[model samples]
Target: MEVVNQFVVSPCVSVCEVDERDICVGCLRTLDEIARWGVMSHEERMHVMTELLPLREAGDVT
Candidate 1:
């Protein structure tokens, strides 16, 4: 038997404050994303970590 463990780490840095745009200044996640993190699937989390967060950080996203 083989076991595969999948864990999606949170980007929170303890700076829990949302900007005027409702994005977290610490983790760079939007308020909705942060609120939904606990219930989001692995793929969803990956999208946030890989795509959304990067775009947000780069100022490409709102």
Candidate 2:
């Protein structure tokens, strides 16, 4: 039997606090996105990662 493992890495960065906009101060991911990470596919995870960089650069951090 062949075992296929699909893994999507998280960019938690160990700072797990949410800002006023409900976005994580560490990863800049919303509460919903963080919650859905486990079930999200590799593509979905990559999409979210791609979206986060802009938000982080826009000063989403606290």
Candidate 3:
């Protein structure tokens, strides 16, 4: 028998909300990105993170 490994995703249990600065208090996802995450591709998520990094550094969100 062969054993397979499964990947687990983050739970994002934070109750953070999207602030006017476009950062989620919890997940820190931008408003536009968060609104589109369900339909976005993995590449898109990567792009969003690129945009988010700067904001995070500036203390925009958690």
Can you give the TM-score per candidate against the true fold?
0.90, 0.72, 0.52
Residue 18 displacement in candidate 3 (angstroms) = 2.4
Ten-residue region with minimum lDDT total, candidate 3:
4-13
The local lDDT score (0 to 100) that residue 39 gets in candidate 3 is 78
For candidate 2, lDDT tens digit of each residue in 12-60? 8999999888888887788998999999888889877776657676876
* Ten contiguous residues minimizing lDDT sum, candidate 1: 1-10
Which residue pairs collide in model 2, if any? none
Candidate that would win on TM-score: 1
lDDT of 2 at 4: 65
At residue 36, what lDDT does model 2 achieve?
Answer: 95
lDDT: the better of candidates 2 and 3: 2
Model 3 gets an lDDT of 0.62
Deviation of model 3 at 36, angstroms: 0.3
Best by lDDT: 1
lDDT (CA) for every model shown? 0.92, 0.80, 0.62
Q: For candidate 3, lDDT tens digit of each residue in 10-61? A: 2244766767776776766666666777777766666555666556857774
